[model samples]
Target: MIGMGNPRGIAGRPLRVLFLVENAPVPGDRRVWNEALTLAQVGFQVSIVCPKWGYPGFYEERQGIRIYRVPLPSLGGIAGHLVEYLIATPVLFLYTALIFLRDGFDVIHAANPPDFLFTIGRVFKWLGKKFVFDQHDVVPEACASRWSGIRMRLTYAIASWTEHASYRTADIVIVPNESVRRLAVERGGIDPARAFVVRNAIGLAHFRDAQPRAELRRGRRHLVFYAGVIGPDDGLDQLMLAARHIVAKRGRQDIHFAVLGDGDCAPQVKQMSQRLGLGDVVEFTGWVKDDRLIADYLATADVCVVPDPKTPVNDLCSMNKMVEYMAMGKPVVAFDLKEAQETGGGAALYVTADGHAGPEAFGDGILELLSSPGMRESMGRIGRQRFNEFLAWEHQQASLLRAYQTLLGYPSVLVA
Candidate 1:
């Protein structure tokens, strides 16, 4: 075991950390941003190297953390993804080297989707730097969910290989949920003692001060909110179908559906909504960055929906939106996914099935929630309580810090 005999680092200097993220940008990627802030609060020098998607500039310092952004092309499809990864890996490596030469980092904390960050981590490990592999998603499963035929098989094989490579290269592994932790141990063959579960939870201060904007309902009697990425695998198309069923079939004109956030499938989703005659009842507010606005939408929401259909990836991965809805004291309607059930507990109503039947069932679940004010209130209370007790970022911080303490060779210190 690597031992420093001190919490900071060898000789009592503050331990420096460099976060390598290829999927998303800093601050925008709430999970990484939350982790960064938590480590910074404990006196660790933190820096992030990520893609410049929504955020501009090459570099910036925010709240004592340094962020280095690389401009990357927004691409799609199997071939595009291959080209994108090939381009991203080397550019990100260059930034990592630059950060090491200038500021220096004791640990290379790499979050994965492409799972290729381990290649860079392996090089740094040779130079005596620690690697913490933060598995954000099951890449192989995600590839399967997004593609089919030869492309799916090829991508899955490559993803599986890279994922295992990442697990083997890491000094410590951090997962978002127990399902992922189990995968890391059993499938990736990592030691159980070295893997940690640090959920993608919201901070306590999140939405603490924002008031509900009733006006956001937009003259409707009830508001149903859905937030996060609108990818094809995310089941947004199913959600639009649900909206059509509610409005056209059930004749429930009293309810309005608000979708916040954008993704690769945003245009397709919008087109479906229009084609289904849901333009009036459904509002697509693409990517609301303002915290207060998001808080307002959630606070005013009668019910929040997680339309992620049952798939290998969706079943195993935790959804951040579900927890966020719970944090706002809003009951959720989600598919009966394993991690979703674990995360939601009694806070959500799970709809079973997939395809056309799934959306119909999902619509029925929404209607059931809308029909009973008392049930919604009770479920909301339960969700909020659960969030406060076990699912908040405050609770997850201890595990994250413990993982770092173990990796850096310091005795575990209580976080808060």
Candidate 2:
């Protein structure tokens, strides 16, 4: 695969950047939206290519940025992802190729793995476009989550290989956290200078920093909140078990647990919550819009939770909800993953990582935090401070800009 090593004549041209995304729409994705808006604000001509969703037909140019959407086969299950990739990849390449043919782009910023867009990036590279690989998910871990058989095993092997190739091809590789940054250097054989860590952070300015809604917290005895995707990797069952433990062992009926956001395991998680006799206290909100998230849930919560299963992949990757929770200045309780501890620091009450820690320890941790408002407030303070210092989007924006500045100065471009 041909990759962009360094860009020539990329500086001072209002970088004609093409951002390629997998499933989500342009404006809807928080990270991608953040990047697009930031780049546009900084005088770059940004165009996002993604799958068509509920938004208007095909092309749109809103807020001095162009967004191009192509029809993908499906957005549902594994079958849908496969179908979407099968059709979407070709259409994506052709659409991008047309754009390249018409107006040569300065940079091709591709986000992924599923890693489908590497082929497109390779095609563009042959035509002299600079390639930037934004690593989102660890493909091998995702593969391990879904598959157990030989077929999936082979697919996993191929995806892993492709991931490495993406790193080798990229002029600059960006990962969300330092752990993945190390992987890009060690596994991908990329230079340390070429790898960047652009973390997932809350746009602190955008999130409504209102007083925690006492009204929402009033009717409930205690409010326990969990947000983000309910995927297999996210260990929702453990959270349910903790809910059950809270009710059965501790007789803690005063606390109500709200699970927000939907994923593959949503239905089963709901069933498990119900079966655990948390019929009243345990609830699911299922993919609330961002505005609703701020207004209805996060603004009112007493405590936030992120219960990703402790896996090799999770330990290395950072969870954005934890950062979001910190952005809102809410105390958090999560399973003890190394990165969580690093990001959360003393801000979160970490439950043990033992398989059993899912429910019982979660119950204990939440109860401990709930019992001490002073401690919760302190944790929240430290968390918000940490957000400002390290994890906010404004900070990441600098790194993103720097990476581009470096690439844009390739080959005889003065380093002024």
Q: In order, what is each prediction's RMSD in angstroms?
A: 2.2, 4.2
Q: Cα lDDT for residue 271, model 1?
A: 95
Q: What does candidate 1's lDDT look like per residue over 1-416, in tens digits?
A: 12223447677788999999988888989999999998888788999999898876988999999999999766778888889999999998999998899989899999987798899999999999999999999999999998899989999999999999999999999999999999999999999989999999998779867677878998999999999998867889989989998998899999999999898899999999999999988999998889888998988899999999999899998999999999999999999999999999999999996666899899999999999999999999999999999999988988888888778667754332
Query: How high is the lDDT of residue 342 in model 2?
Result: 89
- Cα-based lDDT for every prediction: 0.90, 0.79
The candidate that wins on TM-score is 1
Task: Compare the candidates by lDDT and give the number of the best one.
Answer: 1
- Against the hidden true structure, what lDDT does model 1 obtain? 0.90
Model 2, position 45, has a per-residue lDDT of: 78
lDDT of 2 by residue, 78-167 (tens): 566667688888888888888877766778999884687888888778878789999987877677666678856876787788897788
**Could you tally the backbone clashes for each prediction?**
0, 1
Considering only N, C-alpha and C atoms within 3 Å, which residue pairs clash in candidate 1? none
Q: What residue runs in model 1 are displaced by over 4 Å at the alpha carbon? A: 1-6, 414-416
Query: Residue 334 CA error for candidate 2 (Å)?
Result: 1.0
